[model samples]
Every structure is written in structure tokens, then in C-alpha cells.
Target: MNFLADLLDLILPEHCAGCGLAPVLLCDACALPLQGPARPARTAPEGLPPPWTVTTYEGPLRAILAAYKEHGRTALAAPLGEALATAVKAALTPHHLPTTREAHRGHDPPSLVWVPSRRLATRRRGHDALRGLVDVAAQRLRTTGVPVICVDALRQRGRVADQAALTARERTTNLAGALDVTSPTQIAGRPVVLVDDVVTTGASLAEAARSLRKAGADLLGTATIAATPRHHPA
Candidate 1:
């Protein structure tokens, strides 16, 4: 099945989602920036769980994410999700991962909980972009022997203004009290990681962590494919 998909991708001549110059979904040039080692997100908000990102969100990385998330370039999910899987591994080191005995006791693999997209945004994009990426990331991790479960456990509790034009502080203020967990039992007492496509001010990640903690989640960390320069200035 995987071979067939790869063959199809080659046969279809799909342009690169990042640069649109290479004859592939993600060309080598664009993928290079996403190959960085995952590192602790230095801009994590004071109260949020430790977060990790694989690459700086700029240039091709930013373009790829925007295309996947906002422009309906669904194929970009594979590469972006794989990048997310890398960040997840870095966030959950030996000390952070759940013990085998603990996993057996709970009868649940570690959870990958994604920040939910706004209903309107999902509708406009014709899909839940971040959720799709989380699902793919979980699959990729499992293939490499990382037992994990992707859970659609977070939901938007209210509307929020677009964050693009907002400052870091405004983004934090706009997201306050805006998220809620769908099920406490799913996360309660489980080692979990929050997932998102990108982190800017960390406002969304912070809110998601708050809701997870309220649900009794043993939230280990957060993971994303990229982080904006606002958080990692040159």
C-alpha cells in the first residue's frame, strides 16, 4: 500500500507544497530546514508544559505549513507529521515517557492531544488540519516502535479573533478560557503530549495545557513542527 502511494505520487507530478518548484510533494531543498534536531522551545510560556519544535517557522517551513493548513494541500501532512513525530520523541525522553508497567496498568498508550481548530476554520479548510497531522504523526511514531495514541480531546469553548495581527500578549489574552477537554478520563493519569502545527506566542499551547491539567492529565510536554521568530529571534 505504501509503495503504491509513493508510485502514485511520482506518477502524478505533484509540485512541492513549499516552493512549488520541485516535482514532488516536499522537495529536498524545502525539507532541509525541517531536518533540524528537536530542541526545547525557549519561548514556552511560564505556566505551560515544556514544548519542543523541530524547526524555525520561517521561509519554506512556514510556507509548507500554511499550504498544508490553510490552502488544502493535504499531502503535506505526511512530511509535517513526520517532523512532528521527531519533536514528540525529543519531548518525551526516557525520564518523561511512561513506564511499561504504568502503560499496562492504564491499558492505554501515551496520548497525543492536539489543539482543536475553530469550527469555522475547519469548515473553511474542509478538514481539521492539525488533527490530521496529529493522526499521521502518531502513525509514524508507532511504525518506529513508539506506542502512542492520538486523541481528539480538546475543543474550543468559544470564538477567538484571528491571532495573525495580534501581539504576543494579545494572543495570550485572546485565548484565555477558550479551551476545554472533551473527556477527563481519556487523559487523567496518562502521560500525554500536546500537539500543534506551530507555536508563536505559545498562547494556544498554554490554554490547551491548562485544560489538560484540569482534566488530571499527566501532561509531559508539547510538540510542534515549527516555531516563529518571535519565539526564537535571530
Candidate 2:
């Protein structure tokens, strides 16, 4: 299947999502923003884990993500996933070295838990966009010897309204109690990093963290490809 996909790519080369350059999913100029010095998100919700992002959700980066996520441009996953891997690395670097040493002593590395999109949204889109991104990111991390594992431990428990027009508080209210851990055992005692494609109001990630912690997961932090450029009150 992977070979077939590669063959198709060769037969019908794709243009960069950020720019119209052919033969690449994303060009170097557009990818620069994604290769970033990740920092804690400015608009993180209360009680949410420290959130890190590669870039602000705007410009070519925003357009590329929206295309990949909303328009079925799955080919963009390759470059976007690589960018996500970089963000994850930046988030984990300070503690990853010590964790690596512990792994040599037989301790398992941290587990990655992707915060899935709402069920209705996935159904509407006919695919779980976040899952594909998570898979690709995990694969990239493993290739670099990160000693990480991807775990699908979260699911939505109720419907959430479209958040695009919702205020920050409304977004939080809408997501409250909407997410739950599906397998507590898989997450129990594991150092977990929550993954998402984008962070806007931070409501969804905060709700997810609450559920994981309730299930006994050691929530380390969160990582995202991009974040909205709003000045969140500290």
C-alpha cells in the first residue's frame, strides 16, 4: 500500500499546499515557520497542561493545515507530520534526555495520546484527520529513536458545537465533559503528551488533559502544529 502511494505520487506529482510548487507537498519557504523554537501557547486554558506550538495559526501554515485537514489533501501529512515531530521534540527535549537514560535502565519512554476530533466532525469529513497526523508524527519520532509510542486513549463523549464562532469561554463550556479516556490501563502511570493539529482557545486540550489525568495518566504537556495568535490573559 505504501509502495502504491509512492507510485501514485510519482505519476501525479502534488503541488505544495503553501505554494503552488509542484513535486512537493510543502516547499522550503513555507516549511520554515513550522521548523520552530516551540514555546508554551499564549492562550492556554486554565488547568491545561503547558502547551507548545511550532508557529502561529496564520499565513501559509494556516492555509496548509486547513487544506490537509478539511480538504482531504492527505498527501500534506508527510510534511505536516514532520513539522509536528519537530514540535514534539522541542516540547520534550529538556526532559527527554533524562528519560532516554531511564529507558536504557529498562523504563518505558513516554506515551503519546492524540486528542481526537469530535465524532460528528470526523463522520462529516469521512476520516479522522488528527489520527492520520498522529500516526505520521509517531512514525517520524520513532525513526529518530525517540522511544515514543502512540496511544489512542481519548474519545468524545458528547457532541460539541462548532467552535469557530464561539468565544473562549463558550468553547470551554462546550467541550466540558465531552472527552473521556477509553482505556485507563493503557495510560496509567505513563508520561503522556497530548497531540493536536491546532490550538485555538485551548479548551479542547484542557478538557482532554482532565480526562487523561482522571484516568491516572501522568500528563507532561501538550504539542500542536500551530496556535491562534490571540493574546490570552495570563
Candidate 3:
């Protein structure tokens, strides 16, 4: 499966989804159509702020991410993780400092916590996608001299339905209170960032953030690979 997947990626990439491309998932010309996100930072849903999507999901970015997550493209983690690190650094420019343990909305420390998938999902997929990216992102952060901490301290409290077939409201309700910190002592009073694949309604991140808060960790905003566009016209 892995060998075949790799071969198909090389020889059979479709045209850019956002723009018809010259026989590639996305040509260089169209791969970076999007600049950084407009409101690149946020603390909460009501306070949802600028989000940095380093690349638009139109061309190669979409294909790369989809292949990595859905198609088991583990080999692409290095480049994709580097891109994600760039996106994260771009958001942390002003206060990429090692000043204090307390993390404000804008000034975040280096620690990253992932919103864990349900046990069923992880078992079925046989990979922890967020963890893989975080590992590489942590390395990239270190190269830039940013301290990074990966705390897999959070775990799924229960299993839920496949989120893809659900409505936004369902996604929200399904993930509520579904996470908790396993090691409360270690993360106590440490600044932390929540990492995940994507943010649609912000429910999973919120629940994880709430757990971290309960365990005495400072919460920076969460980040993801992709997000559903807000307010698409009918």
C-alpha cells in the first residue's frame, strides 16, 4: 500500500483543485495563492481571530495535506511540518521570546499539546497524524531556537461518530468534554499550545484547552492543517 501510494503521487497527481494546473496537484504558480491568514491569531470562538493558512488549500497544499492524512503519505511529513512551523512562527513574531512561563493570547511559550483522536479512529488509521507533524514541527522550532514541548498528556474520554458526515452543530456536540489530561502534575502551570489537523467549529480544541486549563496550563490559541471557509455564498 505504501509503495503504490508513493508511485501514484508521482505519476497521477490531478490538476489544482482551485485552479486548473499543468498536470500537477498544484503548480508552483498557483500553490501560494493565499498569503498568511488575515486574522492570524485567536483565543476563543467568540474571539476567533486571524488564522494563518500558510498556503491556500487550492493547489498542491490541499493535495499534499490530503495525501498525508487520508492517503498515508507519511513521507511528506517533513516538508509539510516545516511549512506548518513557518506558519506558527509567522503568528508568533512579536513575542517569540522566552520571557515568562505565563502565556498570553499573543505571547505563547513553546509547548504544544495535541487534541487526541478517539481510540477507534487511531486504531483504525494506525497513525497519530497530529503527533507526527508535531514531532517534525518541534524539530523545526528547535532549528529556529524556539523551545518546543510535546505533551501527549491529553486523551480521548470517549468515542464518537465519524465527524465528516455530521453537521457543524453535531461536530460541536460530539466532542464536548471528550478530552482530559492524563498527567496533571507535569503540565501544571505551563504555557501550552493546542495542535490538530483542522479547525471547523473549534469544539475539540476548546474542550482540550479547557482540560489543560483545569490542569493548570496556560493556553495559547490552537492551530490546524486546514479550516472550512467561513460564510461561503449559497
Top candidate on TM-score is 1
Candidate 2, residues 176-210, lDDT tens digits: the string is 89999998999998888898988988888898999
Q: lDDT per residue, candidate 1, 1-234, as tens digits?
A: 245644664577688878879877889989987777898777789988657998888888877887777666788888888889999988877544545555667656789999888899888778889888888888888787677888889988889999899998999999999999988988899888998888888999999999999999988889998887753356
Task: Write down the TM-score for model 1.
Answer: 0.88
Cα RMSD of predicted structure 3: 5.2
- TM-scores, all candidates, are 0.88, 0.85, 0.75
Error of 1 at 122 (Å): 0.3
Error of 3 at 209 (Å): 1.0
**CA lDDT of every candidate:** 0.84, 0.81, 0.65
Q: Assess candidate 3 and give its lDDT.
A: 0.65
Where does the lowest 10-residue lDDT sum fall in candidate 2? Answer: 1-10
After TM-score superposition, the amount by which residue 65's alpha carbon in candidate 2 deviates from its true location, in angstroms, is: 1.2
Residue 225 displacement in candidate 1 (angstroms):
0.5
- Backbone clashes in model 2, listed as residue pairs: none
Clash pairs detected, candidate 3: 39-50, 39-51, 40-50, 41-50, 189-216
Could you give me the TM-score of model 3 versus the true structure? Answer: 0.75
Q: In terms of lDDT, which candidate is stronger, 1 or 3?
A: 1
* Cα lDDT, model 2, residue 171: 88
Q: Give per-residue lDDT, candidate 2, residue 222.
A: 89
